[model samples]
Target: MSSSMSVNPLWLFKVFPFLRWWPMVNGTATRADLLAGLTGAIIVLPQGVAFATIAGLPPEYGLYTAMVPAIIAALFGSSWHLVSGPTTAISIVVFGALSPFAEPGSAHYITLALTLTLLTGLFQFTMGIARLGTVVNFISHTVVIGFTAGAAILIASSQIKNFFGLSLPRGATFAQTMWAFFQQFDHINLHVMSVGLVTLLTGILVKRYTPRIPYMIAAMLVGSIYALILNQSLGDAVTGIRLLGALPSHLPPLSLPELDPHALSQIAPSALAVAMLGLTEAVSIARAVAVRAEQRIDGNQEFVGQGLSNMVGSFFSAYASSGSFNRSGLNYEAGARTPLAAVFASLFLGIILLLVAPLAAYLPIASMAAILFLVAYGLIDFHHIFAIIKASKRETAVLLVTFFSTLLVELEFAIYLGVLLSLIFYLMRTSRPNVISVVPDPRASHRPLVHAPDLPYCPQVQMLRIDGSLFFGAVNHVEQRLLELEQEHPQQKIIIINGRSINFLDIAGGEALVQEAKRRRRQGGDLYLYGIKPAVMEILQRGGFLEEIGPDHVFETRDEVIRHVFSVLDRDICMGCQQRIFHECKALPSPGGKPS
Candidate 1:
């Protein structure tokens, strides 16, 4: 049998499906993976419901998402510990896209959400197959930081409506919500506030004091009990604390994603937006965790993993899904050994959620809101933001611009703007390559470097050093500097450039270098370059510059070229020289001006 078949009969599918992860499992790995999976399953139960509600889906849909998508992504993905599920960013994006079509929580809206998921997954999968993952190179760290911080703020702002039982209008902007929340302060429901505050405190205390407890689970439990007490003390009608009621206690039922071409055409733009936004979040989080773990990321492969997860998830009662920062981090911290842990986390989460659906009827919606508030707060990297404000001016500007843009403009457009700004700044830096005029230091020196600015030149030769790449972007600046050097020192015919450090040279740059050499030669002075590295010399040779400049003119040593060039200078013209720049000039026969 072939090696491919010997490894596994499903190797053909493993190459593309990525779902072979669970089947490839063994004994020792399963032990570590189960431990990690159980830990994650314990944490995600409350978070799944909260995130689903945030996405404007029926609460059960959140648990539905945690099951299938997580399994698919983990099995197919490259990360050992990354857990894929419903996330805050994906929820906000879905709400923004669907609310325009039908009012949130309506049947029409749910259908549209599934349609959007299908389109997004299709696009991501296409991109993965086409190997276009390198496109993410445009997204800088500043853009991510700013966008995440803004998303964090949006999360906290959105939950205020539920947490305080405020009747603020739906679809209000972040700023408007803040204003409305404060304005409606007198109408706050005391019972709701008590449950929410207790839930928030419980989450904090469990995370800080117990540390190992599933704080989210504990907080929700405590909040549910507190709400039950109040309902008993004061009749449910008077206290007015709403419950999540009963959630469907069953496996995720398969459904068809809307595929009408007319429906696809109408929501095509939103699909594109969701695809970009969802893929960006997933890839970014994966890479961030991978960097800490020192693992290589194949962007195209990850695209396939996430795309398949969402595409399959849509049919299995999931809205759009991506990498969840909290769950992925917890998976890593919990000592997950392989992607099997993720698969196990998803499966066990579904089973546990189904068995415990009845208890959800007692869980107060305000408690979920409070838990999400804590989750949102954790997303902001305040220390990093402060450090950025105190450090680089450019990075700080990028951060603020991205942050404000995310809040003010459409989310997809904001990400594009931030990436565009980063590219522009990067181009600006590379466009002006350093063009420096360096002179040899005859003074006391431990190493060879031209540092003294006041040293006199040989009057017939000019030394130049280029400190950056000679790419097409730097062509205009480099050409201008070269022309200026010739114009300023017309009589200094012999030029020797120190090109030892430059490693890359394109055809344009090589042709330009040769053209400059000929320009100097036409003016009755030759061009010589000292310490030309082998790589650069190869480029010059390949580009036909060596033939034009002459092989003898290019020397490995500076002293050799200087010695040869000095002998060619007119002893009679140099005889009456006042400025004896070279030490060699002083050894020459008389009429010389200045010390050599």
Candidate 2:
């Protein structure tokens, strides 16, 4: 790391982007980073093995992911405290994507997993180079909530057989899994169920009451102790408990993915899903950590860093990797002063694995299942789920659709479906930009504007405000609404638009405004605008729309426009009005054109 940092700043920034934090490193920062790194290493030990199980990879591969990718992402990525590695979400996604292509845990499966990693890295790097980090924005928060909830169910279901010692078929659908559990209830293995129950109960208690201790480690310890006692009392043959076995102790070895055309074609769709999901997870974690660290993250740079990490990681036996939310948050809370903390964590993890590999032989499979159940449960954001359900009907629809699709459809496509539905709803809302009718607050001292549906408006003019952007996609809606306004009240030729809320305008919107002005002029009246933002004004001026609408027709405030427009209405018509809504109308003669 020091050797790499000794180069030119510009060159280092290009090659090792995290070197920017190099200058800030000193005795104090190094001590802090080492402490944070040690804390992270301790937390990831059990999590790595669990995540690898989720991905159907060898347990050691999870550690490899934590090591190589963590180091590379820290050195080349944007965020100071974001720790990249194997995550539950990414692991499950990898499993769901590639399980159809090859047998999970087989040599062929490992090869295909490497290939997918390479492709995902390539796609991510290209997107970064293209500066397309904003693509994640289209995937709404509701989509994430729905997909996670769905995935949580999938995770829990996948572990049910292991947790309960049931003989369910592998890779069964959610319904089949549940059905199998119920059918096998009478044949349940009490020993296995007891171990899982103890593990789950221990994890829940430790997490709730003593969060400082790594819950996975604490739970695994208790479950392993219980299993040892059971095995001692009743022989292993009678207990029928299984172990994770000793994990690989050596460093990650060199490997190559099968690059044949058939392999690429087989994995293409899955690779795309992995790439997009990895990016979304990584970027979201980075941004979330950045807020607490009071730092900024470069999404494109983070993309490139994650890409390079996975691309490089594939050759070193690491599967797809992304930012780990738990580890990153722990890094921040553990006093990480720089990205070096993540680097130190990778180094410490490698060292710890060498010492801890043999101890895994005593770890029971039921314990792992129990830990996963907890992880899956944690993924479901119940607070946000209830909030969405209570606050918005449309968002709730997105959440339900995404949640169900995740359970019913392919995991990858479920994400896409949620995003598609979200976009559809968004377009539907934006295309029909809210055209609100506003009136002066008669009860207010300064005549502020408010939406009062029952208020009596002047018969000759209508006051309206568009509360969204007027781009090509929305022009037709705005135009149609304006047309409807004219049709509804033919005598109200003047339309005063309160443009304060309109932040965007395109050529189509400009043309629509010009057409409205022209239509009003044809009827011996004209359109008036008030409180136009500078950006909208620029669009109007640049498109030669201000001339069409006439500069005198625009006003800086609603009150100014209303005052001037009141003077222009036919005096004879005003004389006959029974309801005098505006203060200007009070000065008019009673039932005649003469002044009062």
lDDT at position 328, candidate 2 = 93
lDDT of 2: 0.88
RMSD of 2: 3.8
**Highest lDDT scorer:** 2
**lDDT for each residue of candidate 1 in 1-596, tens digit (9 for 90 to 100):** 78765756465553644454456567887888898898888888888888888778898888888889898887677676678888877787687667767888888888888888888889888888898887666677788789878877887888897898879888777888999998999999988888899999999999999987889889999999999999999988987888988888898988777888988897777677677666777788788888877776778878888889889988998888888888888888777767888888987887897789888999998998999899888878899999999988888888999899877766666777887888888887777777777666667453255745687666777778877777788778889998887788877777777777666677777777778888877888777877877877888898887888788888888778778888888677687776666667778666634444
Give the poorly placed runs of model 2, Cα more than 4 Å off.
1-15, 440-446, 453-456, 530-568, 574-596
Candidate 2 per-residue C-alpha lDDT over 254-334 given as tens digits, one digit per residue, 9 for 90 to 100: 989879998898787778778888888889989998998788889899889999999999998999999998899999999
Pull out the clashing pairs in model 1.
575-591, 577-593, 578-593, 578-594
In model 2, the clashing pairs are none
